[model samples]
Target chain A: MKLVPTIRYNVQDIITKTIPVYYGVFTLIFLTLFSMSKLTSLYMAGSFSGASFNSTVLIVVIGFVYTRSSFRYLTQMGVSKRTQITGKVISILLISAVAVVMDRLLELFAEFLFKSTEMTYEGSGIAFSLFDAYLSKLGPVAREMTLIGLGYTSRVMLLSATVFIAMLYVRMNTAAKVIVSVGIPVLAFVGMPALAMLIPEQMAKLIHTIAEITGLSNGLPIRSILWMTGGTVIFMMLYSLITRRAPIKD
Target chain B: MSSLELIGISKSFGNVKALDDINLTFEEGKIYGLLGRNGAGKTTMLKIIYEMLFPNSGAVHMDGHAIGGNDTALGKMFFIGEKNYFPEEMKVEKAFRLMNDFRKDFDPAYANRLADAFGLNIKKKIKSLSTGYASIFKNILALASNAPFILLDEPVLGLDANHRDMFYKFMIEKYSESPFTAIISTHLIEEVADVVEHVVIIRNGCIIRDEPRESLLDSGYSVSGKADTVRAFVSGREVLGTDALGGFETAYVLGECPKNDLPEGLEISRMDLQRLFIQLTNS
Candidate 1:
């Protein structure tokens, strides 16, 4: 069936309503830290990293704010829940992708303005190396483009997971919703690091094996990136399935 | 054979039963009034039909197809509940655009005309609109939906007299222009009595009266005279209700009063929809 109209409406709603509200809050925090001189360029980079890590969590929070009456309103207006859910997920991804791209571009611009190009590291760490291996299967130009695309896609998937989780919690009571909303990121932040530390030797060996198989050098960032990206994808899939069966309030 | 049908529908919240073994049917091209007191299962029935709420037992069907949560069945129906479902932050025009995108039969021109008629600002956010205007906006959306089976629960709530009149006029006009089945559940019986062809009154989660308006009116009569005379005249008849003020009395009787048998100084009139509704439901 033709799905463009529903997608367009949903995307526009997220762009105009959800994204602005979210980005506004983020911007306010960014400006406040910057103005206080409490956030140096290093802090900016760290915050961006934190944002990327919690991207799904951010999207879920925003989704919770908008999904209840907004989703129901669309349904009441004759849009099917399936169409709405699909459109919403796509819109969340698009917004997340756009936000990440904008942040990276802004970071590059800030580096140039601060005359800190020498101090800045453009390397993608293990993430870039693993991506480079896959990219090398294509040519050099294709590799660069694919790397950029993967970065963008990774960010989008993370955000989409958040939106899915938030929508899933739509039918939950206020306290339970807040718990789930806050719990996802807490689990991600605490759980991943704890897992990594607990199995550092095994993780290190796995990284070495991956590096050897990909013909990459030791200490490549690709292994870390793979772990993070794989975790994100798994989280997103689980979130989508949970939301598909989520109880909606009438 | 029926445009809409419900079979053995049952719903409960915790231990309280909202609907119990409810069965209803609606024919095409007729306006039905779903009248009920508060918490009498009218909204629950409508929601079940629209698939917003699932019946704990039995099924709802439309045109021989089950009205589940599928898009096909949902596309053929429309429901307007008491809640203002629009986002509080959305502008009127944006809301219209959203509606147009979702509902295939949405009439943008009609919505615009209603907006203009009601003096609703297209740029104003829904949260900013007055209560009356908010209801006006919702009514306009319902009117422009053009669905075959439209369920409006208290569509005239919070509307001023002028707007309520306009709403009725618009409903009649829309019905004439394109005949459709409409179920309007409202407590304002008199406001819609003239336009509605059928009346379905529910009391305590059961169908107490379901008949054509003409048939209902034909079966009941209002007798007014001196207290003693009216009481004596109505004593042998099925008395639905009685209202006695000082020495005068008016009794609403359920059966026909023959023209040949006239009680002295007693005046008898045909029961209108409002009186019939009051007499039948007051108990």
Candidate 2:
């Protein structure tokens, strides 16, 4: 009944599950790169970083996996469906922020290591943060703040969408589940390409219009941030609707 | 004192009606045995009460307010069913800790004590536990929950005889120390016949019997003797059921045995809960 406690408990649960996965992936990536650097004499010439993108993917997966498990467990513990959603929403926001900050810190650390080793290595060891690679035109402070906003909004939007998909899967029957599972890839890989081929000019115009609307065509990501924030709100509302009366399945 | 009431509740899965229009009330502090045969809607009713499954035509209420997924009303009850709702990787000790964090009344000391008594390894992940230990893990939480109401669906499933006995004993001890309502849904009727103060028997999605345990037991008596003798003695009476092996027989008859009429070579004893349940739900 205590809303704060329920939200706190869910946030704790999500973080408990997320920490190990996040760190494990980071460790794996670091070990692989270290091994490659020594064994194959691999050298990166330009900005070699996808921390934001990788972290976004990981957070999306964490969202999907925890939705079913947490919903069932919390409901069994007498937490209401509404409370569960509220808890999840807060957790998604908190985790997105944490992931962004952690990724930035790791990038700084990587840059430090690369700079120190640059004199000894044969090739120039340079690393650029995601913000510097994409938003070079902005001032330092503006770039950092915009990147943080972009990270949170994008991660929240994608994770909320993933959570919604997970809830939908839980609600689906076997036949419907099969249909959607097969339908999505077919639509993405085969159907869309065929349609685009049938109407090349129209499809090209549509893609261009969409890119412009989402602010991907422009260098400044301010409009994209607004788009992503709107997306987060929409996806979270859908997620809440699906979860409100969701039954605990056997 | 509080009461949980179900008013005209019904549920269906496709064409198969799981529960019909039914009304039941569970008071604040009595142990109830929700006995039914397999697929008799006992679990369905419990799920509905706990808000795990919504009823199609009715609502569940605590005191006077409807608890249509209300947090405060739901917080008053805990339902431990056969399903393992905990994350697979969670250890038993962490689960107890989380329960403590979730419920104000949750008693961690009691949970740890129960876990030790059951010889459950608190360090092991839930997925690593056997079926019986898993049941023990959940039951321990329910016992230590200290909520106003606890619903146990097949609480003793997969439990060995010794563990089953331990669970029943622990349940009684907990109930006596600080009374709370417990609706135990199980097929093992005889085991809980003495433990449960109230008896509710459901048959084909309908409640056929609801009364005090003593009155239900007093409704009938079992007479055992030669098959023919028992049959003759039970003639013209309401015979719930009868079982025979070789020449010997046991017949369950409605109403009390006539103490004065001592039929030769015949013996009468108290009704067997399992036998009564079998007969009542035989249809």
Instruction: Identify the candidate with maximal DockQ.
Output: 2
lDDT value, residue A17 of candidate 2: 59
Quickly count the clashes in candidate 2: 0
DockQ of each: 0.35, 0.66
Against the hidden reference, what TM-scores do the models get? 0.77, 0.90
Question: Model 2: residues >4 Å from true position, as ranges?
Answer: A13-17, A20-46, A51-53, A116-137, B223-236, B244-251, B256-268
The number of the candidate with the highest TM-score is 2
Candidate 1: Cα lDDT at A206: 80
Q: What does the lDDT read for residue A170 in candidate 2?
A: 88
Model 2 chain B: lowest-lDDT 10 consecutive positions:
B274-283
After superposing candidate 1, which stretches have Cα over 4 Å from the reference? A15-61, A92-157, A174-250, B226-232, B235-237
DockQ score, prediction 2: 0.66
Q: Which candidate leads in lDDT?
A: 2
